[model samples]
Target: MEETDHPQYCGIGIRGVAIGIDSFVWIALLFVAIFITAAFTGQLETGSPGLNAELSGAPASMALGLWFVLALGYHTVFEWRFGKTIGKALVNIRVTSEDGSSLTFTSSLIRNAMRFVDWLPALYLIGIVGIAVSGQRKRLGDRVAGTAVVGS
Candidate 1:
């Protein structure tokens, strides 16, 4: 009857590990973006050994916005298209609708957007609590989006 009744849910611990892997990947991509941006903006020069990361003002704001967009898009695109990110696939877990179907683009976007709330007050502390107590092993994002992360 309700959308939260997912079967074969995974524990938050495994989810945590999967997210760690995903985060690592995101950070790597971001680093590459920063490197390229710096080069194009002339922050790097001939004989320069590394990128200068001390950029500020409008450039810093733009970089921050780019980071947010990339983070959102990374999760949204992977979950919508593949049901799982690389980390989730590697960990044998996936995001699926509450009724055990592939997530829609809307569902994935809603869930990923809620990631900010899930991280409120700390590093996913709210999400961890939600999963630990939601009875369906879901975080805020999953509940909001009518989705679940479960064994693949």
Candidate 2:
């Protein structure tokens, strides 16, 4: 019998657990962002009067912006450096191009940044649909970048 040339990917399209883990990380980061926003917004009522309401909006925006950066930027940089996110590492998976090579920085950046389109209008429903239908278990970003997540 001849062996397959391609690597075996996670059957359920990156697996529920991997997505769950990544979602957990994002949720924690979002919570922190909300807390920081609340703290500066004087909504905390913790008696920190020095925190100005006028300044609150900027910090909140900054935190929110950082959250986006952490999601996309960190993934691009760290995955380029290590071929895996903390979540992917925990799940023993790595992302690579379909041709079997580490993802390029340009591809990673384009893919992650383009998540805005994938997430447009609502609950990432488009991205989820894309992932489910893709043979490579890739979401919109993955498809745009020509990449796949596979077992390590």
Candidate 3:
């Protein structure tokens, strides 16, 4: 890790507002998925067709999966290309290592891929505790990847 005026600081500026932006974006994606499904397949009635029900679940799962992948893609690509995600861009923050170096692709993948682990045991139990207790607001993946989120 590199030393700076704020040696122990987390990255550029991924703060509460970034969290809010992430929530809004994800919720909008979810709702849009729902709306699109309904628009093409018909209303979600109690006694909907069985085939429709099955297709609905598959499509819903696909939509969620797509969102998951895209979110990672956005973060990885934007961060590497522009040093920010959409939310991070809006907030003027960037992610880096403790030494102020850009995160490698593998490192970014490890961090984002382990998001499932941090979200383990339901309700983000592990992640919540980790971030809360961590001095730099690092969750498991961040620690493992030896990276930090900071203001740019």
Candidate 4:
């Protein structure tokens, strides 16, 4: 019997879990950064007026902006250099080209950049549907980038 060349694609459940883990990792890093900055500025003490003011008047927009940059950097760098994020590694999955080759920087950037589209309508419903319908189990970003997630 001849062996097949087809890749074993990753399903949405595992992908969703991996994303959840990645989200937690990013959130933890953000919290650590905030605490470190607060400590450096001598605002770590709860009773300190500076700390109270900082917390009370904190700009959520700034945090959201930082999060956007962090996520873009994290996903792009990992997929470009390693073909897998920490979450994907833990899940034993990786992203690769449609031809089953290593991901290129351009492909990684395209996929990660289109994450906004995948997140449309909340909770990645569009991406979920796309992956389900795609024979190779590709999300919008993956399809646009000519990439797919598969078992490592």
Candidate 5:
């Protein structure tokens, strides 16, 4: 019998692990960048009397803004260029179009952009439900972008 053209979609177990890895990677990178910048800017010097080294007020807001931009960029750029983030690559999986073709940059951007919505009420609960109910195991972002995560 001839084989059907169905794709082997990854389950939440593997996808969750991949995202966990990616989150760690991004956080580490963000910290490193912040440390280097602080060092260069004398923010880490702690040389003045009655001075505290802490993120607060403007600094806190700026850091939060930076984190958002960097995280979004991290996901969007990686998937757009490689069809997988470093985490997904390590997991031996990659994102592809529903038709099993390599995804375009717009597709990657659209999916990654919807990540915040997928996060839902908290901790990807909505995404989990979507994946569980979808025939292709797609999360909100995947369904919206017509993409799937599959073994590479």
Candidate 6:
């Protein structure tokens, strides 16, 4: 195949940095949700209760559910529609099919779902190792989904 037929695979370092950026964004949103929920429910009173206690309440449960949905949606929608999340776009990398075609929703869902496994043993140690060992720099999710992260 011609060089153009195969996009450049993104290495673990850049991918890690991109994920770090995304994680920061997610955390910020989570905090905002928590504060908003707390404010509405009068849980923000000084010294009324611990932050953890407040977070374990109904509003926090809603926020947690929202976070879960948002996290899955973030990856699925972005990868399926644009082939990149905000962080991936900023980093100039994207998820694509092994054949370099546009990514599909099913593939995106599969990869994102497999993230549970990738996150094994904390901090994605398994994912990092998978990326390192795979010739195409594919993480477990990528391998399972038949996709790859590539420079755009």
* Index of the highest-TM-score prediction: 1
Error of 1 at 24 (Å): 1.1
Query: Mind giving the per-residue lDDT tens digits that candidate 1 earns over 1-152?
Result: 14345367988889989999998988987776666666656664455674455556766666667778888899999999999998999999889998888999999999999999999989899999999998889999999999998887
lDDT of 4 by residue, 42-145 (tens): 55667645434143234444545566777788999999999999999999989999888889999999999989999999999989999899889999999999
TM-scores for every candidate against the unseen true structure = 0.88, 0.72, 0.67, 0.81, 0.83, 0.81
Task: Score each candidate by Cα lDDT.
Answer: 0.85, 0.72, 0.67, 0.83, 0.81, 0.85
Candidate 5, residue 95: the lDDT equals: 93
Residue-by-residue lDDT tens digits, candidate 6, 1-152? 24657678998899998998899778876776777677777776566564532666677787787776678778888899999988898899999989898888999999998987998999998899999999999999999999999998
What local lDDT score does residue 148 receive in model 1, on the 0 to 100 scale?
Answer: 90
- Candidate 1 whole-model C-alpha lDDT, 0 to 1: 0.85
Clashes of 6: 0
Residue 43 miss distance in model 3 (angstroms): 12
Q: Where is the poorest 10-residue window by lDDT in model 6?
A: 44-53
Candidate 6 clashing pairs? none
Q: Which consecutive 10 residues in model 5 have the weakest lDDT in total?
A: 45-54
When superposed on Cα atoms, how far off is each prediction in RMSD?
3.5, 4.7, 5.9, 3.9, 4.1, 3.9
Clash pairs for candidate 2: none
Model 5: how far residue 87 lies from native, Å: 1.0
Between prediction 1 and prediction 2, the one with superior lDDT is 1
